[model samples]
Target: MINPALQPLSDYTFARLARMLDGIAPAAGKRPILLSVGEPQIQPPAFAAEAIAAGSHLWNKYPPPKGDAAFLGAVTDWLTTRYGLPAGMLDTERHVTSISGTREALYQLGFLAVPERKNGRQPVILMPNPLYHSYRGAAMLGRAEPVYMNATPENGFLPALDEVAPEILERTALCFLCTPTNPQGRVASLDYLKRAIELAREYDFMLAVDECYAEIYRGVPPAGGLQAAAALGGSLKNIVVLHSLSKRSSGPGLRSGFMAGDPELVGRYAEYIMFGSASTPLPIQHAATALWKDEAHVESNRAHYAENWRIATQVLGNKKGYHEAEAGFFVCMPADDAEALTKQIWREQAVKIVPVGLMAREDAEGVNPGDPYVRIALVYDAETTEEGLRRIAPYF
Candidate 1:
């Protein structure tokens, strides 16, 4: 039998988008410009391909279960340089594990972190509303109660940690906090991250900070979870960070990323990977190593996304309830009925955008925090993104 825990969750964001527009065709003669998904349309660096091809000879061999040492070392160095962590704070051997992508790593973590019971009751997994759907899947499959911490306009679209009751914290087995959060691009402050880290430690639960979009920002780079740990007496206990080359290096097809944090937690996660996980292919590891070691392409990606946001602002800055994205490549546009707005945009402009509610579920009060907005991805080239935005601008 299928896992019963999957019953309550809604269809995933993309799948729902497809079903919503299934029988309806876009406006006649207007080619569909898909702004619904967050996949980047830009080409990754040429060097990534070269590196992969160079390692073609190793294609026949399976990747090391722990990780290729060079790949892990490159990731360690990138984490240190990007987050300003002290040298040697993260041992390449004890504190890192290779994965196919953060989505897989984050979901697999549920198996390693969630227990059958906590405090003699079913455990809870806390995730922000308007979440990355994987978190809820992880919680459900792990047989934990999935609690939604709503991030609404009233709180600057960041989950209010202070408001979670002490009882919920007591039973939490895992908590996922996405920086430069998807759908709503809000970055957590250093203090905010530390408070989360502190709570994770106090509650004896794992705090998984999804930093997949961490590298795609303009102005000051967002603070990382490890940076918060560095300030908190240099301890990584109860904190694990999930990062992906998908956003950072525009290499989602490469399917490589890593988890870094508390040695004990990493040790257990690596052990699980040895037998159960799909080891990242050896060729992809070589490509990831090159991507992590280089920053120029990442900077170029930032500039391109910055231009997309700028175009969005130019088109809809003064439109009612439009907030320029704080970071990352998506902007959530407020609407009276986001689902209706999504259909209207597709029918009239032939431009596709996702209703934010589809990515979120109603909380305890029967309110979905994402109900008021539609999420548009600015992942296309600026010119194409601008064209798509102009087509949908009138609706807002």
Candidate 2:
């Protein structure tokens, strides 16, 4: 029998989307363009394949839960340079461990941080309303109350810290913050991140930052949780920042990334994975190390996304609700009715876009902040992206 705790996670975003468009076929003679999911269409660099091939001889041996020293060192070195942390601020063995992807680590954080009770009450996990689905599922499965903080245009698409009740903060076990947030594409500033860290410390909860999209931005590099900690006197406590090569190197298939911060938390997570999670293969780890060392491919990937944004603006600039995404590949725009519009675009134009309502939780008044918007992923090649935008523009 299934566990009762899983009841709250019945409808995943993509599954719900598929059900919504089930029997309806796309418009006649037009190719279906799927912008519903944020999978990058670009090919990963050739070096990834070469690295994997070179390390393939070790496939017979079981992979290690905590990756090899080379992989760990590569990740730590990259983090130090990326966040501008002090040279010796992070110890390879003490501060970092590799995960298959940030998604796995993000979900595991709930189990890693939640307790039987906090401050004599059920523990709470706070996340933005239009959050990554894994965050909510993680909280429910871990038996923690998932608190939805509404993030809307009024709040610059970031959750407002002041709105959280004092009581919720008191029992909070973990807080999930996504920078270059999914669907919204809003990046959290250094000061904003510092404040969240401060709250987590004050309330004695874990702050898990999902920064998978850290490498895909339009302007200045987004500030990270580790960077904020360095600014706050260089201590890694009550905090864990996750990074992934999925977005950075356009290698989601690689499924390689790491969680770094709070030596205690990282250590516990490594222990948990040792017993419960699958180890990342040795070959994959080798490929990931090569990826972390190279920035040229990443720069090229960013340029492609930048051009996609330019194309979006040129095509839909006059639309009333269109706003250029600050970072990440998705464009979240207001709609008369997100679900209905999503269906209309699918049926009439053969273009698939995600309804933000599917991702957001309802507010106290039962109003979903994302009910009026649709999120479209601009992850295709320039020609494909331009065509998709052209098809979607008419509906707006």
* lDDT of every predicted structure (CA atoms): 0.89, 0.90
Model 1 residue runs over 4 Å out of place are: 8-10
Segments of candidate 2 deviating more than 4 angstroms: none
Tens digits of lDDT, candidate 1, 1-396: 976667645667787888888988889989899999889899999999999999999989978876799999999999999899998899999999887889988887778899999999999999999998789888867888989999998998889988999999999999999998987888999999999999999999999999998988888899999999999978889999988889878888988999999888788877887787778898889999999899999999999999888899899999988877778899888899888888888988999999999889899999999998889999999889999999998888
Residue 376, candidate 1: alpha-carbon lDDT: 90
Give the CA lDDT, 0 to 100, for residue 180 in model 1. 87
Residue 357, model 1, lDDT = 92
Please report how far candidate 2 places residue 221 from its true position, in Å. Answer: 0.6
- The residue-level lDDT of candidate 2 at 173 comes to 93
RMSD of each: 1.2, 1.0
TM-score of each: 0.98, 0.98
Mark the 10 consecutive residues where model 2 has the least summed lDDT. Answer: 3-12
Pairs of colliding residues, candidate 2: none
Q: Which candidate is the best by lDDT?
A: 2
Candidate 1: residue 239 Cα off by (Å): 0.4
Backbone clashes for every candidate come to: 0, 0
